[model samples]
Structures are given as C-alpha cells and as structure tokens.
Target: MSRYDYRVRRKLFNRGQESSHKDFNSFERKYNQRHRIQRASRFLLILIALIVLIGIAVFAAKADNIKKKSAPLESEKELAHTKNPL
Candidate 1:
C-alpha cells in the first residue's frame, strides 16, 4: 500500500480501538452497578428474615409462659375436687 493509504488505515484502526475501549468501560461500569445493587438487596432480605425469626421466637416463649402459668391452677382445681368423697 502507498504511505498515504497506510496512514489512513492506521488512523481508522486507532479510532475503532478507542470506540471499543469506551464501550467496554461503559459495560463494566453498568455491570458493577448492577452487582452492587443485588448485593445490597440480598443483605436487606437476610436482615428482614432474621427480624421475623426473632419475633417468632419471642412469641413462642410468651405462649409457653402463659401455658406454664395456667397449668398449676388447673392441677389445683383437680386436686381440690378429688379430695371430697362424692
């Protein structure tokens, strides 16, 4: 090829390389942003699940306490009735 044609081809090749590099940088930025958002959402979901599990545990403990409190009263009533000969 002539020197002029060689220079023109080199310039076009450089321009194409620059455009492709910019495209790659744009794609990388978007991919990183999407990955960050997904990580944050997963953390939030795990936090919410832990809160719900703690709430359920507390409720179950309270119910068990209520049952314990009522059990003695029921046993006393049974004992009192059984003591009398009918």
Candidate 2:
C-alpha cells in the first residue's frame, strides 16, 4: 500500500476504536447506575420487612401479656371464693 493510503486507513481504524470505546463506557456507566439503584432498593425492602416483623413480634408479646392478665390464677380464684363464701 502507498504511504498516504496506509495513514488514512490507520486514522479510520483509530476513529472506529475510539467510538467503540466510548459506547462501551456509556453502557458500563448506565449498568452501574442501575445496579446501584437496585441494591439500594433491595436494602430498603429488607429493612422495611425487618421493621414489620419486629412490630408484629411486639404486638404478639403485648397481646399475650393482656391475655394472661385478663384471667385470674387458680389460687386467686380460690381466695376470692373463701372471702365471699357465697
């Protein structure tokens, strides 16, 4: 090939490589941004789920306590019967 033709071919090849590199960089940036958002959302979802579970556990514990308090023990019932004698 002639020297001029060789230089032109080299320039065209370099341009093609640069464009491809730029495209790849753009795609990588978009993918990374999407991945970061997904990760953040996943973390948030897990946190919310944990909070909900904790709330449910606390509510269950409170309900159990209420149920226990609403009923008199056998000893207390007997003591009441003795006191009233009715």
Candidate 3:
C-alpha cells in the first residue's frame, strides 16, 4: 500500500493509449534524420583529425631535411677554421 506503486501511477494517468501509426512514422523519421547528422559529424571529425596529423608529419619531414642540409655547412665551417688555425 505504498504511495510509490506502479498501479497508483497507472490509475492516476490512465496510461494505456497506443499512439497512431502516423505519429509513430513521424517520430521514426525524425530519429533517422538525427542519427544521420550524428554519423556525418563523427566522420567529419575523423577526417579533420587525419588531415591535421598528415600536415604535422609533412612539416616534421621538412624540418628534418632543413636540419640535414645545414649540418654539412656547419662541418665545412669547422674544417676551414681548423685549417687556418688563426
């Protein structure tokens, strides 16, 4: 006889009316539209992340190449200084 029983809630709301087929169809359409938008957003997010990662990798490779090109110049300068010894 507690006040939190299911029978009490059902009696108070009279909650046994089934929705019409048209109403159910509208709900399903809205649900499907929202699901498609969510899926597209997820795909776009992944694509953007991949692009950023590829850009970072390309930038890193360029930086490594620049460092490699500079290393020989620095060694040549050292060799010249040693030969002059002044």
Judging by lDDT against the true structure, name the best candidate. Answer: 2
- For residues 44-63, what per-residue lDDT tens digits would candidate 3 score against the true structure? 99999999999999999998
Candidate 1 structure quality by residue, lDDT tens digits, 15-59 = 435554568778999999999999999999999999999999999
What local lDDT does model 1 show for residue 46? 100
Error of 3 at 10 (Å): 9.9
Residue pairs whose backbone atoms clash in candidate 3 = none
| lDDT accuracy of residue 79 in candidate 3 | 92
- TM-score of model 2 vs. true structure: 0.53
Worst 10 residues of 1 by lDDT: 6-15
Deviation in Å, model 2, residue 38 alpha carbon:
0.2
Clashes of each: 0, 0, 0
